[model samples]
Structure formats: C-alpha cells, structure tokens
Target: MFFHQDASFEQLSIHRVGNKAQDEFYVLSEQPVPFADDEVLPGLLMQYFMSPFAKVNEVYRFMHPNEDLELNEVYHFTKKFFDGKMDFHSLSEQLAKHLYEVSSHPKIKGGELYVVHLKNVQMEGDSQEAIGIFKSENKETYLKVYPEQGGFQLDYEPEAININKLDKGCIIIKNEEEEGYQVLVVDQTNKSQEAIYWKDEFLKIKIRNDEFNQTGNYLKVVKNFVNEKLEESFEMEKADKIDLLNRSMNYFKEKETFDQEEFEEEVLGNPQAISLFKDYKSNFEDDFDAKFEASFDIADKAVKKMESAYKTVLKLDKNFHIYIHGKREYLEKGYDEEKGRNYYKLYFENES
Candidate 1:
C-alpha cells in the first residue's frame, strides 16, 4: 500500500496550461508557491494531491519502446530535479511546457497544473521522497453563507476548485531511479481520448513487473481463459464454468506460491483443457507484453482485489441466480422433458 501520513510539502509550483488545439497558451509562475505561513492550506493541498494515491498498489516505470529511458521527457526532468541539478520552479516550468505541447488534443481542457515536491512518503515498508504532479481541469461554483449585520448572507463563488475531486495526478517516488522510479498515478477523467495523453503520451510509462503485477496479470489470464477460451474447445455449462473459477480462486488463496504444472494438474484436471489453457496464457502474455514466471509468490492483495471479479453467480434465463461456491459434483444440471424445461438439482443438506 502507498501512504503519506507523515508527508509534507517541500516545494509547490503552479502553472496555467491551456488547450493548444484551441489556440490557447500557457502561463508559468515566476516562483514556487510559499505555504510556510499558512497552516490550513498546506493540509488541504496535500489532501487534494495525495488522497487519491492512498490505495494505489500497481506501480509503473518510465519506459521507451527502444529501451532508452532518457527518451522519456518526464523521467528526464524528474531525475534532474531529484539529483539537485535543477531547481523546483525550473523543473515545474519545463514540465508545464511539455504538458502544453501534448495538450494539443481537442478534448483536453485547460487548467492549473501543480508540481509538488513531497517528503516522507511511505510505500510498503520504505519511506521516500516523491514528486507529485497534479492538474485541475474542472471547476465548480460553491455558495458561501455568512452572517452579515446579525442576518444571514449568501454569496456565490463562480470559480472554485473542489478539493475532493482531483482531475489528474502522478506520484514519482525517488527510489529506483535507474529502473525509472516507482511511479503511482491517478487519472479521474480517463474515459475519453484526451485522458490518454496524460499517462500514455505525456508520462510514457509501463507496468512494473513486480509481484503485485505478476499475480494480478496471471489471475486475469486464468479468468480470461476460463470465460472465453474454455468455451471454444469444450462443451461446458455456466455452473461448471463457475466451479472452475471458484477452484482457481481457492488455489490462489490457499497457496503461497504458484506453480504452473501443479496448477494445471490440480485445478484443470483435464489434459486437453490444460493444454488449451497454456496456449491461451501464452497469447495473453504476448498481447499484454508481460511474462508470467513459472513460479512466484502470490500477492495476497492482488488476490483480494481480483476476488470480486471472479464471482460465482450463475444467471439462468433472468429467473434464477445460483451462487455456486464449490463442489460441482453436488450441483447437477438436467432437463425435465415432462415440463419441457431445463432444471437444476442442488444437493444441499441445510436449507439455510
């Protein structure tokens, strides 16, 4: 998990980035924003920038297709700033300019870009300094109510930023500079073409092949194989599919490490099914550009996160929803010729 409980802002620089496609321009601040005197603003700004990253587990690194890390613009500037070769204000300005160049997307909205130098961010067991890059593209109107002359007064603030909603954010940890740093990012508006520019075009980052990623990706491969590929090669009922999913989840939950051969033999007992699953897993790895090790420690967090997706509900013709947890042998599927309908025979001792 990522935490910033003891984190404090070291430097903050705000710049106005405009939509370049609309012929708008950007404005850079002359100096960093000072918050030493104000006590409350710092906490609010910190929440705005850091709160969204509290539960981010997946990590990414700056990557280039040709294996040249220096080619990544964000990585270059951040590395220089971390090495003390460049000042915070200068680095923020350069980053703002780079963002403006990529803001050419027509759907990209102009907003205030905030560059923050944060200290004492804790991730897992290690504490490290991190750089926070945030942008506020959307604004809201808030009504202010105050007492005036013993009477209630109301005023409207036309341009107000809601601290709770952060539009886009990226946290670049100082650790692992040689491996492109441990970067955690958030893009709340990542539903459109414009959102792609923030992480893909601007950051140029790729998923780090850590334990968390390995576990999550492998689980996804198994799920996809069960749901999609399994049907192509075999005739199976929805209940049977759910049983396979339940078995897969149970294997991950009970075991500390994953062994491909052992998993195939136990969870997928059929030799033909195991062979098909291996081919599908290989294609999945190739499509995602990820390699799943033959054996690795299973990440509990990844398993828990993926548990919700591996639901065991079997929906039957919008009428009955059977939740099959385990014991596929106990649940039998058959046809009732007399009633001219299909039915299920569930053998359960307890009604409750």
Candidate 2:
C-alpha cells in the first residue's frame, strides 16, 4: 500500500490551466507557494493530494511507442526536475502548459493545477521522494457558522475545494527512472472523451505487468469465459456456472501459485470444457493485448478486490434468489410440469 504518514512538502506551485478548445489559455505561477512553519495547512494539503492514493495498487510507467522516452513530455520534464536540472516552479509551468495543450476536448473544464514535491513518502515499505500533480476542476460552496455578539452569524464561501474529492492527480515516484518512474494516477471527475487527455494524451503511461495485474487480468478473463463464452459451446445450468466460479475463487484463495493444468483438472473436470476455455483465453489475450502466465504467484490483494464481481447468486424468475456458495451437486434444477415452471431442489444436512 502507498502511505504518506511522514511525508512533507518541500515545495508547491499552483497554476491555472484552461481548455484549449474554448480558446482559453494557461496562467503559470512565478514562484513556489509559501506556507507557515507549522503543520496545519501542510497537513491539510497533504490529505488533499495523498489521501486518494492510499489503496491504489495498479502502477503505470510512462512510455512512448517509438522507444524514445524523451518524446513523452511528462516523463521528460519530471526526469529533469528529479535530476535537479530544472527548478520546481519552472517544472510546474511546463506541466501546466502541457496539460492545457491536451485539454482540447470542448467539454473539459478549466481548473487550478497544483504541483508539489514531497519527501519521505512510504511506498511498499520504501521511502521515496515523489512529485504530486493534482488538478481541482470542481468547486463547492461551504457555509461558515460562527457566534457573533451572542448570535450565530452565517457566511458562505462560493469557491471552496473539497479535500475529499480530488478531480485528477498523479504521483511520480523517484524509484524507477529507467522504467518511467512508477507513476500512480487518479481521475475521479471526467470519464468520457475528455478523460483520455489526462492519462493517455498527457501522461502517456502504460500499465506495468506485475503479479497484481497478472492475477487480476487472469481472474477477469476467467469471469468473461464463464459468463459469455461458456454458453455458446455447452448447455450448462446456472448452478454449474456458480460452482465453477466458486471453485476458481477457492483455488486462488487456497493456493499460492497457479498452474493451468492443475486448474483444468481440478476445477474443470470435463476435457472439452477445458479445451474451449483455453481457446477463449487465447482470444481474450489477443483482443486486450494482455499476456497471462500459466504459472505465477497469486496476489491476495487482487483476489480480495475482485471478489465482489464474482457473483454466486442464482435468480429464479421473479421470486427467489438463491446464493450458491459451493457444492453444485447439492442443488438440483427441474421442470415442474403441473405448474409449468422451473424449480430448484436444495439438499442440506443442517439448517441455520
């Protein structure tokens, strides 16, 4: 996990970036932002920038398709700043200009951009310096209530930033310079055409192929094969599907490493089903540009994060919702001729 418990701001600069499509421009700050020697304001700003990254597990590295990393603007400027070849204020201006250039989408909003240099950030039990780039596009109105002359007075601030909701942010860690510096990003506001500019057009980052991603991607492929591809080739009941899902989850939970042959033999007893699943997995890898290892260490964090999506519920018409956890043989599906409907017979040894 990423943590900033002991992190402190070394320097911070804020600039305004406008949408280029609307013929707007950007304004750069002349110098770094100054704060008091105390920790109150710095602590608040730290929470604003770093709180959203606490549970972030996916890591990305800046990349250029042409194999020249200098072509990536963010990577270039960030490397210069980290190497002390460029100043903090100048780096912030350059980053703001780059962001404004990519803000060509008509629907994108203009906002204040904050660039901060942080020190002593704890990332996976390692201390590293990081550059935090955050943009606040949305403002909230907050009302202030205070006692004045034994009476409460109310005042409202129209343009206030909510610390809890960060619009767009990324932290460039200084650990991996040769591999694009281990960047973590957050874009909570825009998700449409405008969102592409933040991570794709501007940052130019690609996912790092690590154990976490491998585990997550493989689990997603398995889920898609069960939900989409299995029905095309075989006639399987809902209980059978749920059982497959349960067995998949249990294998990942119980085993440290994954083996394709073992998984096929244990979870998928049918040889034809295993062959079909292998073909579907190959297509999935080709379409998504992902490679899955036949044997790799399973990440527990990925499994826990993806557990919610692996549904085990069996819905019957409009009345009953049976949650099938395991033991598919215990549940039987049959057609009731008298009622002209389908029914399930559940077998159990004890009742709760």
Q: Give candidates' CA RMSD values in order.
A: 1.3, 1.6
Error of 1 at 162 (Å): 0.9
| lDDT score for residue 33 of model 2 | 86
lDDT of each: 0.92, 0.90
lDDT of 2 by residue, 204-249 (tens): 9987778898898888888888988898889988888888999999
Q: Which candidate has the top score in TM-score?
A: 1
Off by over 4 Å in 2: 36-38, 269-272
lDDT string, candidate 1, 1-352, tens digits:
7899899999999999999999999999999998899989999998888899888899999998778998898999999999999989999999999999999889899999999999999977898999999999999999999999989999999879999999999999999999999999999999987789999888999889988999998889889899989999899999888999999999999999999899999999999999998889889888767888999999999999999999799888988898888989998888999999889998989986
Clashing pairs in 2: none
**TM-score for candidate 2, residues paired by index:** 0.95
